[model samples]
Every structure is written in C-alpha cells, then in structure tokens.
Target: MYLTFITMIMTLVGTASSASFSAPNKDLMTCTIAVGWMGVALGALSFVALLQLRVYGYINTFIWNRKPTGVYFIAPIIYIISMSILYAILSFVLPLNGGFVYNNITNTCVAQNVIYYIGLTFMIIQTVVLCLLLFKARTIDSCFWEFRKMLLVASVGILFGIIVLAIQHVHFGDDKVAVKGILVIIFTLLPQQVYFYTILGPPVYHLLRHREYYLHEFAAIVEEKGLAHIYELAGGCPLGEISDLSDSGKPYRTTAVNRLSNDSNFSGNEPAPEIGAPLPRNSNPRQSGPLLSYYKSLWNRASRNN
Candidate 1:
C-alpha cells in the first residue's frame, strides 16, 4: 500500500519536473502521463482495499485451487484493458465543460461501482503478487539483494499493518468508538510511518546528496544539442552558469577529422587516431576546467599504456 502511494507521488513529481525543466516530446509526454495514471489507479485501489478490509474483516480474493494465478495474472490483463478504454473516454469528456463535468461523473452510481470493483481487483492482485515476490526473493541471485531488501521491508511493514488490523477486529468488536479511533490510527497511519523510515527515507537522502550529477548530465545534453536557449526558455539559469557551477565543462570536439585531412603523415585508412588524442590548441578555453582536464589526463594515460 505504501509502495503504491509512493509510486504515485514519485510519478507526479517526475512528470511535473520534466514539464518544468524541458519541453518533453509528444511521445515522452504520452508515456509520462500513462505511467502517472497507472500509479494513481494503483494507489487509489490500495486505499479502497484498506477501507474494505477495515469494514468487512476480510478482503475479497479470487483464488483457484489455492493458487493466486487469478489474482496475479488475469487481474492485471483486465486492468490494463479497462483503464485504457476508461482513460480514452475521460480524455474526450474532461475538456467538454472546463472540467466541471468531472464532479458529476464521479458522483454517479456507475462511476462508484466501477471504482469499487476495479479497486478490489487491483488490491487483491497486488497483495498476492507482493507475497509471491517476497517468497521467491530469498532464492534469487545476490546481485538482486538491494531490490530484495526494499521489497522485504515494504512487505513486512504491510503485513504488520494487516496483523494489527486483525487483532483490533478480534478484540474491539466494531461497536466501541474508542476502539474504532484506535483502529483508524493503527491501520491507516502506522503503516505509512513504518514505510517512511524503512523504505522511503534512505533513497530520498541519497538523491538529495547526488542531485548535482543529474543536473550536470542534463546540462551536458543541452550543450551537445545546442539547446542552451531552451534551458533559458524554461526559466533555468543559462547553460554557461550551470557549466561553471556544476563544472560540467564543454562538450568534446573531435580534431580527428581535421587532423586526418591535414596531416601528410597519415594515410586515408590509417585506423582513426587513438581515442585519447590530445585536444587541439584551439580547444574551448572553458574546457580547461578540472573535470575536462582530469578526463583528458586519464584518456592520455590509457592511450600511452595501450
């Protein structure tokens, strides 16, 4: 549940950041929106399942022969097809009344039923898949340990939450207001708290520490494409400023073509100059920064060794 919520929030953040920082191509925008909608659907379904579990003491699961194939396999196929059609209809309808009609549509009986059924299906499928993955994770290769740890942490947190809810159901008997309040706090709030510390916190800190790397890479791409103007248009500092602060250095220019043409010592098909050829004397002054100098030195050393 917490994983789905985090996924949805991250998707929204990624989409918004992409739009703000650059002009996404049509295909990129389409893919981004598709991922965002899928996350939203999953998050919504998880929330609904929690509520149903709270009310009914059990979640409806579609099992056959004590296996979860129906939950893990058939449900996802149905969800993808249904959501594709549903989103197509929504895209056509959403703009018809400046979005006011969305309120009415959401309030309708058909909409409520669809939400209920789809949410139930999604929750069951996700829960079953998560358990299966956790069971299989122990035997997976060591290369997957990082991912396995994350899954294990989240799965344990969610399982703990389920157990707490069940205990409350057995002890409190649904009639006491005080017990109801306790149930809400334990079931709704505790799991999110657990997830934050165990699953979400470390990556967020790592991203904050290394954010400059992402900015540097973006600036390098912009410089390569001669799209510095686009960065300015997006309300970012000019590429020169970013390059100075991030020390990304100028993109490399090949003197190979010029050297090949001019050097009388070289034949037409002498295998291209080794990759670590020294920069021309006329190379950009800005490329004299530490980042480029280090790379150049490393390359020259490798070429000499070869």
Candidate 2:
C-alpha cells in the first residue's frame, strides 16, 4: 500500500517537473520522446527499488504475494526493450510529419515516430503490468486489492490508447493519414499530456509536498513502532505479502483499517532493523544534495593538493 501510494505520488512529480523545453537544434518531436524516456527510466528505477524491498522482506503491507513476483522485474524489462524497437520501427516506417520528410514543425515523420513510439511503449508496458496485477487480486482479499484501483485507472487510459494504435496499425497498415493523425494526437494529448502526467511521479511528488524523505520515513516508522507488531495487527498475512489498501467506493470502505495493504515482513526475530539494518542507498541524485556543492568540495581538495 505504501509503495502504491508512493508510485502515484512519483507520477505526479514527473508530470509537474517535466518541462516541454526542447533543444533548439534537436527536433521538438525527439525532445518530447526523450522526456518520455526519462519518465520510463524513472518508473523502472522506482519499480526495481520497491522490488528489492520485497526481496529483502522489508514491507509490512498485505497485498503483495508471498513470493516476489518475478513479473515485477520481468515485465518492465520486456516492455522497455519491445517498446524501444517498436518506436524505432515506427519512426522510420511512418513519419509523423504529415507524410512528408520535413513538412511539420518537428523534423521528418521518422523522428516523430521515434518520439511518439517511446510514449506508446511506456503506455503498453504499464497496461500489461496493471492487468497482471488485477488478475492477481482474485487470489487475495478485497481489502488488499483496492490500492490497485487507482493503478487500474492509470492503466486503463494507456490500454485504451494502445488498442487504438493496434487497430490503426492493422486497418491503415500502420501509416494511414487518419490513423497517424488520430494516434499522435491521442497519445501526445490525452494520456501523454494529461493522464500520464498525473500518474508517473508519485514518490517525488509526495516528497515535494511533505518536504521530508518518504522512503526514510517509512523505514523509520517501521523501526520505531516495530513492523512485527504492525504485521500481527495487520492480520498476520505472511512474509513478503502486501495487503490491498484500496477503497471500495462505499462509505464503510474509506478508512485506513478497511484499506488492504500488502503484507511483507521486516526482521522477524533475533534482531531488528533499528539495531542498524538500513537499506543500502539506491543513488537517486535528484533528492540528494546539490551536485554543484559536491563539485565545489572536490575542487577545493584539488587546489590544496596543487
């Protein structure tokens, strides 16, 4: 549940911080594609970090399964590679430049294809992962499955767009005027400009709002309060399982107790994380100290040495 909340917050941050600013020399289409890829990288990094937490049995939520879903890691990898190739092919096969090599404000159709495909690929990967999530819910309790509801909303939008692209690829043979126009506008506008902007940067967004480190807070809270007790109170779900903390759209379902969170355990016995089992740092520089300050520190050392 915490991770899911963090995910949504990260999406919001990505949308808020991402600028439409482009390089003067680089095509605007490519620029947009590059920005989209950055978001994908950010999302992938976040997924990997959370997956690591699961592997280490750090989470106390209940929605997660007993075993770390290898799917969590596998899906993202396949999606990124497949999407990259798809984007590359689309860029060359059907130019988004109004069917001309250089008719639109951006570069040739191929460049636009490259840019649009990156976003499209992200959309597809998100959808597939979400669908897998939805299916996994049937095996768990309703309370543990609700967090995925918001995930469903985000995934649905992406899936809808992918369906459109698939049909366009078939009917118009992947390069028809109506299909390309409809696709570029749909992907770049609806989900790209709005939906994705809303869902891609939840962790950063949460930090921006709280002005405190969330990951640290989660660990600290678990340490101070004791995750084992929390787990027992949370219904003794199991090690490495998260409970669903999603709402049911009912008045009775809005409370935190009703929300099902995934239940993964912290240290079970012998020793606790507080005695000092801090999760190793993952090196996300954005939230870290200033790079300029680091450079300054290094330069001072160099001057002294000279």
Top lDDT prediction, candidate number: 2
Estimate TM-scores for all models.
0.32, 0.34
lDDT of 1 by residue, 234-281 (tens): 122111111111222223111112223233332233332322233223
Off by over 4 Å in 2: 1-22, 27-36, 39-122, 142-148, 159-306
Residue-level lDDT for 6 in candidate 2: 52
Can you write out model 2's per-residue Cα lDDT over 163-213, one digit (the tens) per residue? 656744554432354444445444423433332233334433543443123
RMSD of each: 18.3, 16.1
Q: Which number leads on TM-score? A: 2
Error of 1 at 306 (Å): 38
lDDT of model 2, residue 242: 33
lDDT of model 1, residue 296: 44
Q: What is the C-alpha lDDT of each candidate?
A: 0.35, 0.37
Report the Cα lDDT for candidate 2. 0.37
